[model samples]
Target: MFDLFKEKLADAEQTVAFGSRLSGACESPVCIYLHGDLGAGKTTLTRGFIQGLGHKGNVKSPTYTLVEPYELADWQVYHFDLYRLGDPEELEFMGIRDYFSDTSHCLVEWPERGEGVLPPPDIDLTLSYAGEQRVIELQANTEAGLRVLNKL
Candidate 1:
């Protein structure tokens, strides 16, 4: 029931602001996949999103650790950067299902690297460079995603 939603971000701040807006639409127990090239503002967007959800501290990419967990007042957020993943099986070994509980929110970057190991995303977010700015697109693939889009 959701169509495409697109926006142009004039700079990093705008990207973050857009993310803050998106956070308002995000509910718990959902997975979001982020697609973008290096330095394309993926982490920046996520920072705004987490912060917008009332996280007071820093929100950085888990480039080395692969995953970062944040405990907010009402929800658990897990940010995953699988760029350095040596094998998708590592996810199963780590009990990935435990991290994606009914009360958790997952934002995954480089999801292609996870392939069959990762769960399908409810929302697919793509960020691309447009001249000196960036363009963002959001697409919904599930009923939960459609609800998030409605909130948007």
Candidate 2:
């Protein structure tokens, strides 16, 4: 079955809080694909997720860098933004395969840009503008994702 969850966030803070909740339910070795337009709070959600997973420093989008690595006590989190990717082939050169490990959590923004190069997402999260607020819909594509949704 496809496990699903939806929420309407009143503001950026609420969106972040929702992301934090998701972070709490996630286990390592999960790939999450974030789909949203510009200024849709993808990075904000990522900030909350990383913080909730026990990171203390500032969380920034990996827009230019492509990927940012966070080494936590028990998990290695990789935040990837493929918005600027000129070609999906660039991923191979960056050693993208090395980032998604059995002990890591990967949150990718603009995953469609990577297309065939990106790993299949366990959970696919779509954020959309709902007037001045935002609506987030999460869909589980794998068993691991279903478990996470159940926890949520």
Task: Provide TM-scores for the models.
Answer: 0.96, 0.97
TM match of model 2 to true structure: 0.97
Weakest 10 consecutive residues of candidate 2 by summed lDDT: 21-30
Off by over 4 Å in 2: none
Q: 50 in model 1: Cα distance from truth in Å?
A: 0.4
lDDT against the true structure, each candidate: 0.89, 0.92
Model 2, C-alpha of 135: deviation from truth (Å): 0.5
For model 2, residues 20-135, the per-residue Cα lDDT tens digits are 89899986578999999999999999998989988999999999999999999888999999999999999999999999998899999999999999989999999999999999
Evaluated at residue 105, the lDDT of candidate 1 is 87
Candidate 1 lands at a TM-score of 0.96
lDDT of 1 by residue, 1-152 (tens): 36778888999999888888888887657899999999999999999888888999989889999999999888888999999999999999988878888888899999999999898999999999999999999898888888887887
